[model samples]
Target: MSTPTLPCPGCPGRRNHGQYLCRTCWRSLPADTRGRLTRRDKRAVLRLQQLQQALAARTPLQIIRVSP
Candidate 1:
C-alpha cells in the first residue's frame, strides 16, 4: 500500500491530519501544516521538477510490468 497524501489547502489542518502532502514528501511536512505555499517552496518545487526530469530522461519510456 502507499502512503496517504498530506493535508492540502482544501481545508484546515486541525480538521484532518496531513493527508494532502504528495506521498514522496510526507516526511517533510508538519503535523500542523501552514497551508500557504512560500516563495522558497515554489522555487524548490521547480527544482524538484528539474531533478525529476533529469532522472526520467535517462530511463527507457516503455514499461515491463503491469499493475492490477
Candidate 2:
C-alpha cells in the first residue's frame, strides 16, 4: 500500500508526507525575513502568503447584510 497523500492547500496537487504544502507550493512560498520565527509564526506566514496569492488572482466583491 502507498502512503496516503493529501491535497495541497495552495494548489490542486498532492501534499508531501509530513508537510502542509506540496512541492510546488513549497517552492512558491515567499522567502523568510531576517527575524526569529516560532513554529506557529512560520505557519501563519505561509498561510498569509498563500492567501495573498489566491486573493490577487480574483476580482474583489463587496457584500452587504440586511436585517429586519
For every model shown, what is its TM-score relative to the native structure?
0.26, 0.43
- In candidate 2, the residue pairs with backbone N, CA or C atoms under 3 Å apart (3 or more residues apart, or in different chains) clash, namely none
> Global lDDT of each model?
0.33, 0.46
Worst 10 residues of 1 by lDDT: 59-68
For residues 3-68, write the lDDT of model 2, one tens digit per residue. Answer: 539976656678766665566655554434211111455365665454445535632211111111
Q: Pick the candidate with the highest lDDT.
A: 2
Question: Where is model 2 poorest over a 10-residue stretch in terms of lDDT?
Answer: 59-68
Clashing residue pair totals per candidate (backbone < 3 A): 8, 0
Cα-based RMSD of the predictions, in order?
13.6, 11.1
User: Candidate 1: which stretches are off by over 4 Å?
Assistant: 1-40, 59-68
TM-score of candidate 2 to 2 decimals: 0.43
Q: How many backbone clashes does candidate 2 have?
A: 0
What does candidate 1's lDDT look like per residue over 1-68, in tens digits? 55434453322232224233343343343322212222245455554343345334642212111111
